[model samples]
Target: MLTVQEIRELIKVVDESAIDEFTYETSGETVTMKKSGSKAVAAVPDNGAHTDHPVDPVKNSQPNIQVEQTEVSSSDEKPIVETTADFDHEIVSPMVGTFYASPNPESDSYVTVGSKVEKDTVVCIVEAMKLFNEIEAETTGEITEILVEDGELVEYGQPLFRVKKK
Candidate 1:
């Protein structure tokens, strides 16, 4: 059996690490802790294996939305462009897996920056549980930016790309 001091030390070490989850088992002791990152406003008891401590549910709960608005005068010496952040974001890949841009190595990318995409456009493919899942762009617009890299592990509801509403 592991002593209380041993458990405390293990928890401290796991808490300091960047890994989201950790686990340990001894002859008569087992402990696990899962960290939820910096976006969770509150932590609830998740019915997974790790429940020894309350995990902070910050970064993985909801997307932190930000809107910025800028105004420009019409009658000015220079033609000014105003920026109004009134667009909606299309999040994709609601699973834990690797995201790929193309179907294979020798295929063209599904979408790119400045590419106009319609609803149901296959933006990317996510590989989960050894199965390929094609992720589509839920909204229609020009892909302004891709929020993730090719062959990257994506979290649930992670913003895959930014679309400027048309």
Candidate 2:
């Protein structure tokens, strides 16, 4: 049987990872965790049996763990770009990964707000599945705004930088 602390640690790891669900079974105990938007629902079946039907662990005196997402947003959620007048071109992420502003921790950032860049210039790096991919400035422009921060997770097609075309 897993202790409460051990299970909580596992939940933390799962919440941090990109995985949406995790299940572990040993002996007769079964623990299953699922991520629902900003909250995590963790349950341990009272009977220690896997079933297709969902049950309320709280009603059965089973352990229930709820973890909140680390990132928080305002109740009035606003779009990143309110208007097209702010920029002429957008440098979108090519893959889902962690964004890096510089080549390494000790190096200066590849580009900053108002920095000029030309086609084929390496602007940043995206790390996915242990591979660091160099993202280029496919269009010539001056960076008007950076849409994402260093080490933030970005999705495919998500805008990373807004550029004013030269």
Candidate 3:
């Protein structure tokens, strides 16, 4: 079995490099890393099947991706013109783990919608293998959206919060 530190190092290397996919196998255990869209996924084998989990990987800044949706008018008129809008900066999970909105159940979440944050501010916690890791908002902004519920399982690179940059 690979140590947690080893896995973290691999994730860091893969995240920083331009390589799109990577895999490693040893002693019947296999780990695969792949980048898709803006998300990076790491998979490990369980009973001959691969299960994806989040791992500690640094986020790489990329240009905003725009998606368009078309809606028909209620009167059956022509479709409205497409409008372009920029997306907020996404705060992603650094590892696969259970998301906790607060330090404890009784505590308020680190941040909520409209909550302003600095680059070093901790926004949430992710628990993996009994280890609780604090996640930070690497960009200064106001929280615009929280993508996951407390106690939910989050995959590596999964967006946890969307921040409207200051």
Highest TM-score model number: 3
Q: Candidate 1 vs candidate 3: which has greater lDDT?
A: 3
TM-score of each: 0.50, 0.52, 0.56
lDDT of 2 by residue, 16-96 (tens): 778898978888656776776844545542221212222111111112334321121211222345446478888877554
State the C-alpha lDDT per candidate. Answer: 0.51, 0.63, 0.63
Which 10 consecutive residues of model 2 have the lowest summed lDDT? Answer: 53-62
For residues 68-119, what per-residue lDDT tens digits would candidate 3 score against the true structure?
1111111111222222334469888766557788877777888999899999
Clash pairs, candidate 1, are 39-58, 39-59, 40-57, 40-58, 40-59
lDDT of 2: 0.63
Decreasing TM-score order of the candidates = 3, 2, 1
TM-score of 1: 0.50
lDDT of 1 at 164: 84
**In model 3, how large is the Cα lDDT of residue 18?**
89
**lDDT score of residue 20 within candidate 1:** 63
